[model samples]
Target: MKIGVMGAGAVGSFYGALLARAGHEVVLIGREAHVAAIRQQGLQLSSQGETHTIPLHADTSPAALVDATLVLCCVKSPDTLQTAREMGPHLAPEARILSLQNGIDNLAALRSLLPHTVSAAVVYAAVGLAGPGQLEHRGGGELVMAGDALDAAGFRAFDDAGIAVRISPAIEEELWSKLVLNCAWNALSAITQIPYRALHAATGIVETMRAVMNECLAVAAAEGVQLDAALWSRIEGIAERMPQQTSSTAQDLARHRRTEIDFINGAILRRADAHGIPVPANRMLHALVKLLEDRPGLPG
Candidate 1:
């Protein structure tokens, strides 16, 4: 299989290298420093104290996708439309496009810009970009894909490449579940400059998470989406199991990178307004993250 990965960030490079290891021809479209590193020496996968090089092609341009049979849209939520435009003109007719992004609207955004068959993928992983051409895995790595349009061949191809994928009929629910989680922890932790562990250690922390999640649930209900029973207990499990981690949003702010508060909390606010639902909690969270995204770091 020929695969093209957009962004070549932590998530993109991690999956791209895994597929390459499984014998697929993978091409990563990333920044010049990382692209140069991958081209000079294969992509390096560092996880659980293991590191090795996986041979693959890398380029800084979307043109690298010309021969791909599948396109993995891995850019951050804000860049979805722009990245889709850049990769739009080069997509193959038969290539299957999968959105491995954080937000729910990313698939719809990409579909509007490109003619490719797009699927929403539910990502369950904790990985980061350690440096140029390098991926560091911190947690789980499994995927649940949207719809039946993707088949066993596709799953096998990716699984053979070490990236596991499953077909899901209720992908919207999955997205909302993750969205609520993101809302609960991402921006708050980021704003406070605290990791998940420290963020949860304070008083009213779990209560705070529930307050945000209840707002999300109300919004989801008004929008007529059903959440799985797994939400509450699953999120409850997070604090005890992995409380030390900060959100991707928090990490973005820490590095001075643009955060995706708009798509996450901002999305909720939009939907709440659309449905006449009250989302003061979400609105306030959105405002704080916006303030942080606009300003520099938390004060010294």
Candidate 2:
């Protein structure tokens, strides 16, 4: 299987390393520095208390995707359409694309731009780019994917690479559930610059998270997505599951790079406005993150 990972940052690099380690042909399309490092040495993957240097192809061009049978679209939310446009002309005729990103709209956005089978996977990994050509996996690497994009061969390839995947009938609800979890933690973690366990232990943190979760739930309900009633428990338990893991938003802020707040909490704000529902928690978080993005030097 020839697999290409677009926007191969932390998540993309982690999975690409695994698939390559499993003896599949994998190419990572990413930034120049990361790609250069991979081309020079190899992809350094640190996971489960062990580090391995996995040799794979890396390129800074979408043309790297030309021969790929499967492409994992892992770009940020804001870059979805533009990345799709760049990669579209380079993809194989029957290539399947999977969106392993945050937010609910990426799948539709990809389907809109590319003439290919595009599906989404609800990613449950706490991984990050430790440095150029380096990926660190804190914990959690399960994926819940849906749609007709992945055939049996594709699933088998992912399974052989040690990626935990399951098909779900209600992918939208899964996306929303992940969104709600992001809304609850991502911004707060970014602002505080702390991991989940420490953030959850802070004074008044539970109440704050509950308030944000309520607004998200209200927005989801208004949008007609019936999320799991026990989703909140799962959200709360993220701290216990990945205690040291910081949100990707936190990682972005720490790197002084752009974030997907616009798609996470900001997504809720957009829908709430459309439904005439107030989401003060989401609103405040979105604004604060935007403010930080604009003024990176500001103290939190």
Candidate 3:
């Protein structure tokens, strides 16, 4: 089976390498540097203190996706529309596109832009770019796919690649739950440029997170998704479990790239506005992240 990974950044590269190692034909569509490096030397995958080089196809062009049987749409939320528009014409007619992105709206955003039936996956993974053509996997590599349009062959293929796959009846709830967590920490980590532990250690930070989370919960409720009662606890526990971890937003800022603040926290604010609920904390965080994105050189 031919698998194409669009936006072959950290998450896309990790899965593409693993699938390639499992003997599937994999092609990664990404930047020129990563594609060049992969063309010269196979993708470098590092996990659990070991590194492995896996041979695969790489290209900077969306045209390379024409032959893909399955396409993993892994671009950040901000790039969803453009990616869908660019890749839609190139995707094979029967090809399946699964959104492996953050934020709750990417699935709809892709479906609206593409002609094919797009699926959503609740991705549970921690991957980061080690360098060009390099992916470092930290932990948690499981996937929960939603909807009935899933291809049985695709499920088997992902399973064979050592990726856990399951069908969830309440995928929206799961997504909203994750959104709550992202709202709670991503902006805080990005603004302070600190890891979860340090962010949690700061005075009044946890309470501020609670304030943000309560608004998210209210918005989720208005949106007809009842989040888990343990959501707040899980949000708080993330810091303890991943003490040294920085939010993706923080990483984006550190790299001087665009952050998904608009998609994550900004989504919450939009929903709150529609429902006429107040989300001052979320609003402030979202605005502050945008400010930082616009002028990243701003000092404390």
Candidate 4:
């Protein structure tokens, strides 16, 4: 199978490398630095303290995606619409588009921008770019998608590549749950520039997280998504499970790049405003992150 990965950052590069290592023809469409590095030195993936160089095709142009059977859209939330528009004309008509991105609105955004329905994937991965064409995987690489989005052949391809893929009927609920978790961690961690464990270990931070989760839950309920009580535990447990992992927002701010906070916490704020829900905690976190975003050089 010829697979194309758009926005070949850490997540895209990691998954594309796995498919390539499994003997699939994978092409990564990304920045010039990454494309040049992969074309020269292959993709260097470091995980579990072991590093491997996986040879694959790469390009800076979306034209490379013309022949892909599947296109994994791995760009950040803010880039979803523009990226989709740019890649739409280049993609095969029958190619399956899977939004392997953050937040809850990317699938809809892509579907509206493109001529086809875009499938959503709830990604549970902690990966970051170590260098050009290099990825550092901390933990978690499972993907959850809608049952009807991928056919039998699609499922077989993913299974053959050793990817953990789950098909669920309640995908919207799952996406909302992930959004709740992001609301609890991303902004706070970004403001403090702290890892999960250190952020949660601070005095009153756990309680503050509870407040954030409560606000998100209220907003989710108002949006007609009823999240479970266990969602709180799952959100809290991420710190224990991935103590060293920092929020993507934290990494983005450190690099002076724009974050997905607008889609994460800021999305919650939008929903809350629509439903007349009071979410002071989420509002504060969202505003603080926005401040940092507007002034990237501000010391954390």
- The best candidate by lDDT is 2
| Pairs with backbone N, CA or C atoms under 3 Å apart (clashes), candidate 3 | none
Q: Which tens-of-lDDT digit does each residue in 117-225 have in candidate 2?
A: 8989989998988889988999989999884659887998898999998789898899999999999999999999999999999999999999999999988899898
Candidate number that wins on lDDT, 2 or 3: 2
The top-ranked prediction according to TM-score is 2
* Candidate 4, position 101, lDDT: 88
The residue ranges of model 3 lying beyond 4 angstroms of the native Cα positions read 147-149, 296-300
Which residue pairs does candidate 1 place in steric collision? 196-243, 196-245, 197-243, 197-244
Question: What are the per-residue Cα lDDT tens digits for candidate 4 across 1-300?
Answer: 888999998889988988889898999999999899999999989989999999999999888898787899999998998898899999888888888888998988999978765788888888888779888999988999999777676777788888899878899999999999999999999999889998999999999999999888888888889887799889988988888989989998988888899999989989999989999999999999888888947443
Better of 1 and 4 by TM-score: 4
Model 3 is weakest, by summed lDDT over 10 consecutive residues, at: 291-300
Question: lDDT tens string, model 3, 8-85?
Answer: 988899889888898899999999999999999999888889999999999998999987889999999988999999
In candidate 4, which residue pairs get closer than 3 Å at backbone N, Cα or C atoms, i.e. clash? none
Q: Which residue ranges in model 2 land beyond 4 Å of their true spot?
A: 296-300
Arrange candidates by TM-score, descending: 2, 4, 3, 1
Candidate 3, 241: how far from true, in Å?
A: 3.7
How far is 237's C-alpha from truth in model 4 (Å)? 1.3
List TM-scores for all candidates, in order: 0.93, 0.97, 0.94, 0.96
